[model samples]
Target: MTRGFADRIPVHIQQVVEAMVEVFVNQSENIGNEVDYLQVFELSVDTADFFSMQAIAHSREEPPYSTTTEFVTDTAITEKVYIISDDYGLEGEVITYLLASEY
Candidate 1:
């Protein structure tokens, strides 16, 4: 049986997603309070034919309540393959802020 796009997406997008995750985690710790790290609730990436990609990340400290988000970019692309990583300078800041004050 073949896995579907949702399953494959994580493998293909892990690098970028992980980088985004790292930034959020670091920011959480820097907030100078006891913050929680729960888990990633949703992560999706959409790629355009022009090799540009948009990543949407949603995470939460508790289930069913997403508290973080991120958007990454495609760093490399071919006709059929694409690479995405954290757009730390942009999207990373958005997500980090979401969690920082929530704690």
Candidate 2:
């Protein structure tokens, strides 16, 4: 079953996650008041581990962003996926895409 977006990351770690997202956004290229691209970070709750899942920036008009997931042994252990919508918005808009852990 899919988990709720808010439930993916524990309350204690949300701040850390958000801070990391902000750092990524600040470092990314700014294209005409909007971000040039988006980034998805796959995170593991058990190991406190995470990795980037590169995403292509879709039009702001698009409802859902487009992304590609390259399966690796470690990804199967991931418990949550954070989707950062590369746009003009501030860091407060980051969303977490929750995944059911297989391990």
Candidate 3:
């Protein structure tokens, strides 16, 4: 995770984010090769204190599947881009959370 994005994650919902990542991995893997290594996450603040996260498992050959969750917190998450990647950047099961501007 980029420092900016990591820092943007609300303190009270840290565990929620971690669990979301784990669930995203399982959904992607269960779908098999239909999904490519890269995954996408759409994050936003629906309300001033509400954070919405939509994790998408995308595939070039098929339509994307996504899972979403919402959190009510005292602080809103401002950073808003999520992609899955390894140290190599574009390949591997590792998922990364970072701001769109940072990339």
Q: Please name the candidate that would achieve the greatest lDDT relative to the true structure.
A: 3
Q: lDDT per residue, candidate 2, 46-75, as tens digits?
A: 322464332222122222233333322322
Report lDDT per candidate: 0.41, 0.39, 0.55
What would you estimate as the lDDT of candidate 1? 0.41
The C-alpha local distance difference test score for the whole of candidate 3 amounts to 0.55
> What TM-score would every model get versus the actual structure?
0.40, 0.40, 0.59
What C-alpha lDDT, on a 0 to 100 scale, does residue 27 get in candidate 2?
46
What shift in Å separates residue 83 of candidate 2 from its native position after superposition?
A: 1.2
Candidate number with greatest TM-score: 3
lDDT string, candidate 1, 54-88, tens digits = 44544554323334443445532211122122345
Give the range where candidate 1 is weakest over 10 consecutive residues by summed lDDT.
Answer: 76-85
Show pairs that collide, candidate 2: none
Q: For model 1, which pairs clash? A: 16-85
